[model samples]
Structure formats: structure tokens, C-alpha cells
Target: MSTNNQNDVVSHAINAAQANAEDSQAQQQVEELSSMLQSSTADANVDTSSEE
Candidate 1:
């Protein structure tokens, strides 16, 4: 392969790895937010029930 082609391939590989890492990080953030929401909702429910 030509030097230009090799460079392009390496660039693409690096970009793909970075994209995958970003996606994984985003997924982790979503999971953390969901867990926090669920925990808060459960707490609110308990408080409401106790007041009844």
C-alpha cells in the first residue's frame, strides 16, 4: 500500500477507537443518571407513603 493509504488506515483506526471510548463513557453516564433517578424516585415514594 502507498504511504498515504497507510496513513489513512491508521487515522481511521485511531478515530474508531476514540469514538468507541466516547460511546462507552456516554453509556456509563446514562447508567449513573438512571440509577440516581431511580434512587430518588424510590425515596420520594417512601416519603409519600409514610405521610399517608
Candidate 2:
């Protein structure tokens, strides 16, 4: 293969890896946010019940 072809292949691979990393980070953030929301909802429910 030519040098240019090799460079193109490497560039594509790097882009794909970077995209995957970003996707994983986004998923982690979503999970963390979901957990926070669930915890807050539970705490709010408890507080409401205790107020009765």
C-alpha cells in the first residue's frame, strides 16, 4: 500500500476510536444523571410521606 493510503487508514481509525470514547462518556453521564434523578425522587417521596 502507498504511504498516503496508510495514513488515511490510520486517520480513520483514530476518528472512530475518538467517537467511541465520546459515546461511552455520554452514556456514563446519562447513567449518572438517571441515578441522581431516581435518588431525588425517592427522597422527595419520603419527605412528603413524613409530612403527613
Candidate 3:
């Protein structure tokens, strides 16, 4: 294989890896936020029910 082609392939692979890492971190943050929201929602519901 030519040097230029090899370098292009490596560059593409590095970009893909970086994109995947960013996406995974974003997904984890979303999951964490969802969990926190659900917990707060449950607590709020309990408080409302108790007020009745």
C-alpha cells in the first residue's frame, strides 16, 4: 500500500474513534440525567399523595 493511503486510513480511524468516544460519553450523561429525573419525579409524587 502507498504511504498516503495508509495515512488517510489511519486518520479516518482516529476520527471515528474520537466520534464514538464522544457519543458514548453523551449517552452516559443522558442516562444519568434520566435516572435523576425519575428519582425526583417519584419523590414529588409521594409528596403530593401525602398532602391529600
User: What is the TM-score of candidate 2?
Assistant: 0.52
Instruction: Let me know the TM-score candidate 3 reaches against the reference structure.
Output: 0.56
TM-score versus the correct structure, for each prediction: 0.55, 0.52, 0.56
Cα lDDT of model 1 by residue, 1-52, tens digit: 6445654665565555556656778667655655665566567657766887
Badly placed stretches (over 4 Å) of model 3 are: 1-22
Deviation in Å, model 1, residue 4 alpha carbon: 59
Best by TM-score: 3
lDDT of each: 0.60, 0.60, 0.61
lDDT of 2: 0.60
Q: What is the RMSD of candidate 1?
A: 19.9
| Cα error, candidate 2, residue 47 (Å) | 0.2
Per-residue C-alpha lDDT of model 3 across residues 1-52, encoded as one tens digit per residue: 5445654665565555556656778667655655665566567657866887
State the displacement of the C-alpha of residue 8, model 2, in Å, after optimal TM-score superposition: 48
Model 2 collision count: 0
